[model samples]
Target chain A: MEMFVHDETPTAAVDQREQVVSALAGSVRDLVDATIRSTVADEELLAVRAGVDALVARLRTEQRPGPAGVRYNSEGRSWSWGNAVVGHGNAIAPPLAIDHDTERGRSRAEVVLGAAYEGPPGMVHGGVSALLLDQIMGETASGFKRLTMTGTLTLRYRRPLPLGPVALECWIASEAGRKVTVEASIGNADGVAVEATGLFLVPRWAPLAADEQPEGWRRSAEG
Target chain B: MEMFVHDETPTAAVDQREQVVSALAGSVRDLVDATIRSTVADEELLAVRAGVDALVARLRTEQRPGPAGVRYNSEGRSWSWGNAVVGHGNAIAPPLAIDHDTERGRSRAEVVLGAAYEGPPGMVHGGVSALLLDQIMGETASGFKRLTMTGTLTLRYRRPLPLGPVALECWIASEAGRKVTVEASIGNADGVAVEATGLFLVPRWAPLAADEQPEGWRRSAEG
Candidate 1:
């Protein structure tokens, strides 16, 4: 009956299954990227299409009828792989992994932008940068305890971020009432290419965490 | 010597190929959604992976080593299928298509959100809504006559948008020198779910279009 104690499954077992599923999903994403850039002839393309469809049906021999909504167990392990940014099943997401330091309210991410994220020429899609920034910044603000929505975001693309590895770093700028401000930037070894500032706020609808709660917002360190 | 004459192919031919590629790519997108929700066992998943990879390889038998950049022809027809939002090859992109009306200085889009775009529970991802708005707003500002980049974007997530059909509309709010302000929103039959305002600017490195230019901004009706 306690908050966040819906299931008693050990975090280890949950994570192990998650790892297996994510790895498989990553490969599927790779296939998607390759399919988009291919210039093969129509006859071959149609054959491939039929094959892919059959394979998909095979994979879906058993399936979840609904989306994979967020879930957390008593062990404090939470997984939301359906997320657009970090869902292991998501090939559309950049190869991004962020290291969060709750002590300092800072987060850092390193990712490689490939052909899929390209917007103009070889540069990253401007919105991709925004998507990445909005996510990392929101994570830094929420720290997994409270759900925060991006209120407003301002981005300045000073220079093109090429289709390759990029670095992202951010920190909480300020907090007033329920509003948390975050500043972030993405770049390569050359330097920062895109800079961002965002305002994030906890919605009124969410029940505020009480002070008596034990470890209210701790994201599982393993993930 | 005329402007935007980089290719001599008939616009109709180019568009036909684009249509074909997009249709094939869309099927792959469906497969992607299926893969994420599949509950099949490891043996079946592995077999599916191999089959999908082989299909991808067949499609990529011919390829372009570089990103697909925007191309315009003498007839004022342009295509930028690699664009992050409108890219036909980009399965990660929201199925978004914007119809820009240069005469009215407005842009409209109709889309259907699916499993891939969820952020909170069954609602559309906030970032996805922001991404859609950014692209449509940019197009409204440029009118397909010049290059523009998002300088800053402000979004307010009014309410959760469920996974389903939605509508987007935008118009140029104002233009001052190289800066253009655009207002936009996304909604469904229920009502508007997200609202946005963005500032778009011509990069300093880009040469400004001459004042005497004839038919300064022309968007092809076909997208």
Candidate 2:
């Protein structure tokens, strides 16, 4: 069973669909933020709920039987629209745009968490910070050239991260055969908030020279 | 800087709003699932987007300036409607109905993992598991009697948890001074998939004898 599959969908078609679905996802993100902060009267909320249900029914008219797994075309273009962290169609995900410098084994993203991602008052949830670091560090280890699965993740809560703009960075600390050690952190101008050290492993079944087809393994930080 | 506050919203009013808002969140969750698997034409997607935008505008007519913070009433009814793990108003939060037995120092929740939470093909995202464990363990440590913040969390992924029904449980392993040690896990009939150990701390600023008013600190696993 190949971890990455060639689904035969052309890159252009995938891009077009992504644009439309991403626009919808963006609106849903706004809806979530608004919903969290809305103090409207019950009557207004009920009316809006009805409207949302109607939209949902309309969209359900056409559907796929299961989740959108990561897919790549024969031309080597890949996309993961259902990913928990970077899926374009996932409103739950903070809009994270990672910049991967494969040569330096580093990856970074800047995001502003809002109401939906809150844990404590005016602060980003510790778990949310872990979620972001895991995704970024996993990507850093994979480098889009090989498949990597998280083995162990350890986090230290150095300080509270406020609910606003924050930066995340991860780098390859070391590697031993199939095991890659990654160090990551999430913070803002004040310094690191949550620091993480993760061990990611390239499964034994993966091809040894998968790097020759790096594009096929790309997982949508650039999608 | 009190972590738990008596916001003065009447319990009855809070319950009524929770019912209405929870219904909306349920609908939104279904919408997310459908969106992920949808293979609809671009024209249809665009139309759905427009309908969604209108609904969002309707909801935004009257809104709070910021995120929803945890609040409680004089009657000691507490609600965290925006919590990432247990918020009734948060569509992104899985429907986690936690059963907390304070006397036993244990907390458990049963949830069904779905498409939107996917990471590896058909499997639950690693970070999502961490998020759930952190919340459940934190609640177990607090026992709704004292304020506890996550100090450190370490996770080991034993196996991939599939996207379906899963169970989570946490217990207070030990305690030393203001620090509490908690052990938690997420698994199914096959046994544990992920195991975690977390350190929870009662900040120096929190008053002692908080157990006198446990209800005042109760958060929304029971909302």
Candidate 3:
């Protein structure tokens, strides 16, 4: 894929940039899974780390002081490159590309877990499950145009989730003043193994008026 | 303090061994707090790690394979040295020593987070809060005599928890077949900052006969 930098004016160039970011994010996600499941020797592991460090150095030649926060363009294109959930540059996140069904008030994503996420034998780590759930639930609560923080999360592991491809589905269960409830689940091709319910809060301190177009706050909140 | 090896005789040694283990656990807990809050330089960090590695080597001179599981004696004394909540030899655990009051169905622990636990500026990491709460709520659900696994946990951070000394309290709210509910909170001495609720399940597959002797299952469940 060709890389396109963001431009001063919103145009097809911006959309192309987003596509490149998405493609890069997908590759990074693949790297994560490979790192986890690699049977490579310790020497190889150290060598790989060095290679990654060099790549990071190259990126640092021109970069911001801190993480990439959410950003959006006038054309309504939003991007988050440092997000733990969907960051295009974060290798730790699964290759999860969430598809928001705005009309249905739901979202779904599919990803595979490999060695890096393993906890017991061949199963995914319990904490990894929680991390994925948090992001998806948080997004469900926000519904693509609002802001929410995870106020609370509940999870139940009905069975051990195998290290393989899985599907995650989430939907807004209910919404109240500053509080949105979300329900989500993760399952293998065969059946569901884990289920979650979460309460997300738009802190009383944050702006409640979705109509108000604040700058950084609105950008971060929307993405 | 002198470390005393357990005696082969079952009768007199049980209580004596328990006392020694408890004292050692206390010292280990202190070490955790010190490690967190220490302003020691990088050289000191390396030296400390080396010292710890040597100690581990000495201990491993004669040992079994894999991680330690809960152990008990014929005299009915039980110990768990690999527990995430109350392990005696685990340096990863935060400095937490929970006190259980059976009569009141309550439990409390005090801890201080430091550089190692920091997430946003001076605030404790969100995952660290979840970890600490999981232990307390799990213990509260177990009531120190029965087994429980965290079936579900929910937390609300009303405000950012500063990385410093804090108090945590948990108590049972209700119970229903194989499920115990716990309510807990963490805060600075002045007031509450985070509150949590948990639903702990005594897996249906686990033995439910509380009337059984020895209580190995119960001891393992507290984590």
Best by lDDT: 2
| Weakest lDDT window of 10 consecutive positions for candidate 2 chain A | A214-223
How close is every model to the real structure, measured as TM-score?
0.88, 0.94, 0.56
TM-score, model 3 to reference: 0.56
Ten contiguous residues with the weakest lDDT in model 1 chain A: A214-223
| Candidate structures ordered by TM-score, highest first | 2, 1, 3
Please list all clashing residue pairs in model 2, or write none if there are none: none
Q: Write the per-residue lDDT of candidate 1 for residues B123-209, one digit (tens) a residue.
A: 676777777887788778877665677777787767768778999999989988888888999989999988888888876755446
Evaluate model 1: give its lDDT: 0.71
Q: Candidate 2 regions off by >4 Å? A: A1-5, A211-217, A220-223, B1-5, B212-216, B220-223
| Candidate 2 lDDT by residue in tens digits, A83-196 | 888889888777577899999999999998888887876678788888888889888988877778888999999888888899999999999888999999999999999999
Residue A161 CA displacement from its true place in model 3, Å: 2.2
Q: Arrange candidates by DockQ, highest first: which order?
A: 2, 1, 3
Clashing pairs in 3: A36-A116
Residue A175, candidate 3: Cα error in Å is 3.2
Per model, kept true contacts as a fraction are 0.52, 0.62, 0.05
Error of 3 at A76 (Å): 2.7
- Chain B TM-score (model 3 vs. true structure): 0.76
Q: What class would a CAPRI assessor give candidate 3's docking?
A: incorrect
Write model 1 residue lDDT over A100-133, tens digit each, in one string.
9977989999988776776666677777787788
Q: What is the DockQ of candidate 3?
A: 0.06
Kindly give the number of clashing pairs for every candidate: 1, 0, 1
